[model samples]
Target: ITDWKLQKEGGAWNHCSSSVNHGYLRAVIIALYKKGFTGKDIAASKIASKSTIYRIIKNFKESGSIVVKKASGRPRKSSKRQDRLLKLIQLRDRGTTSTELAQEWQQAGVRASARTLRRRLLEDGLVSRRAAKKPLFSRKNIRDRLIFCKRYRDWTAEDWGKVIFSDESPFRLFGASGKKLVRRRQGGRYHQSCVMPTVKHPETIHVWGCFSTKGMGSLTILPKNTAMNKDGTNTSSESNFSQPSRNSLVTNNAFSSMMEHLAIRQN
Candidate 1:
């Protein structure tokens, strides 16, 4: 304990990043070296390790200074132009996986590791993530959608406000179709935000609902195995709407399973 205190007071061994601190410690070690303190003796004092002390002395003898020289680290395998080419190749085919990108990069005369490729792409702000899913429309579907938009383009918000858009969406009774991520506070296990809400087997049913710009309408669950059509449950749903919204529109027309606007009326 007394020896350690003396060494610490003289110049303690500390983990330092700055060269100045290392240089000061090197000076202290050199001073001790001059006073005939052998490497084993300095190691015993625990001021610094025997290997570090020897290295510092060797450096001082060679450089004529207490400051240790810094060695250059491992060189980068890819050049700037090669990295830019890699980004271009990556952007050319976004769906290409890292493994596939490595192959492609190899074909272009650049042999880069998968980790190296990822690091380069990260530098370019291009990160790998799951591609979002979207419904692909046929030419006719596109034309129909465009026509529908054009037809309603002239209508004012008040004209559209009277409308109620209705649709039937089926939900899984057992569990969610896909996992949903929720941000939760600590110790909020029983809180509403942390709850994984799901309809139990009995309460689960196919619901038909109405939506409007003003507000929402009543929600009614359909009975099992009933084919919904314009003349069936959908027409009956008009009465179930609690709001005095006189207008009505049933998109995604049930008859054809196409986006067809129907029964849009203002009373």
Candidate 2:
């Protein structure tokens, strides 16, 4: 058997220069052999087996170079066209899914799997998919908005500010909070029982208020007993305070109360 010391020493010269020491292993073997080092001594260096060292020496005698043959493996799948197509898909359809883009590419004469498209898109610094935000309004909504703007063009800033804006909005105590893609399982209903805000008729009270830039006025929570007339008049059957139910009386009382409060604060 070859010794470890010779093999280790032989490997040092073998690893040094690939250009100058092109047949380095064979040169080491010959050099060591001439220097009174046996084949067992060369094998002991652990660089190569004794048989491998002999084979290298024989091969060098026949061929000029000690370079190993190139390896053979599966060729790369993507061509330049495929790479360009991936970049094009990434640039054009930023938030589109890989599956959707793959289908699109197939239609455009490039057949690729979703996995392939996903990998390529990732390599090209593009995400496979993303959440698409829901638009706040549509074309009809935009048209109605423009019409409202045009109609309110004559109103002054103070006039607009004096006009109190109030709208009813529903709030659920336990509602799902985000926009997410929901997938229905096998034999399962598409709808899940999530808390939805709802208002029962007669249970909900009507709230109205008026305000100006200077101050806010009293907010009125109208009871079900109060009747609203077609002429935009409030009529109550009974009065808690010593005030008349007539519209003029109510208006005058409210104006006097507001003015008196303002005067008292000003003093």
Candidate 3:
């Protein structure tokens, strides 16, 4: 026997362990055969099953080694480097379709199917998902939003609690809201393509509502083509009610004024 010893715990070739490497089994069988051990004696040594030992011995006699040779067949469509390029394309534009990605990747010197491209992206931890819808803001709008956030950054919860926030929105009565698909990795919630952009005003019925930390305040449907006056009143023929109080912190086109005028006249 050789000086090589096997650890009894969690080691193969010791007390009939099942996790024996093919090379190790082949070496053991050859070693035992050279030592004048019969096939039956080698089987009893517990290195491998009789069938496995005989097959390995036969292969060794014919090929001189137990290493598996590469199979002869068609080559892969995309190499590892090409697969990485596909991933880069996906990261650059998550909204790109698999077919589109395949088309783009062809320019990079690789021809592959869309399914294959998707598989490569999946292997790299990219998944196809519906992009989240977000309100689109212009550069000026974004700057104003940042300024607003910073101005109120230090406000306490109590201070915010007293503030009433209001907004006007339109809901489509007869139209489908389209959705977009995107491929993204984990923790990419804020990616540009991963978010759906919403316009400032969509063509639909305009409704106004206001809420506070205390509770909901008012809900009103604004009339179509209604315009505000210098006193912040909706100057439509339907909105001819009592004039607004001068003490009201009004705007030429403020939301609270429209909501209040609608609410008072409805009662």
Candidate No. with top TM-score? 1
Residues 1-267 of candidate 3: C-alpha lDDT, one tens digit per residue? 333334322444454634454456667678777788777877775656789878776776788877646688897888998888888888998999998998999999988888888888888999999887544557765555455556656879876665544555666544336666778889987798687667555556666554555566455666664423443322321132223323322232343434444443466
Candidate 2 per-residue C-alpha lDDT over 2-87 given as tens digits, one digit per residue, 9 for 90 to 100: 44345446766567676555455556666666677666776777556779877765664566545555678766456777778768
What CA root-mean-square deviation does each model show from the true structure?
9.2, 13.5, 13.1
Clash counts for all predictions: 0, 9, 0
Q: Candidate 1: lDDT of 135?
A: 56
List the lowest-lDDT window of 10 residues for candidate 1: 258-267
Once fitted onto the true fold, the runs of candidate 1 whose alpha carbons sit more than 4 angstroms away are: 1-21, 25-71, 179-205, 213-215, 225-227, 242-248, 253-267
After superposition, the stretches of candidate 2 with alpha carbons farther than 4 Å from their true spots are 1-46, 49-75, 87-96, 100-113, 136-138, 149-160, 173-267
Candidate 2 global lDDT: 0.54
Pairs in clash, predicted candidate 2: 2-40, 3-40, 3-44, 4-44, 4-45, 6-41, 7-42, 7-45, 8-45
Best of the candidates, lDDT: 1
Q: Write the per-residue lDDT of candidate 1 for residues 209-247, one digit (tens) a residue.
A: 767776776776777644356665446556766554333
Model 3, C-alpha of 21: deviation from truth (Å): 23
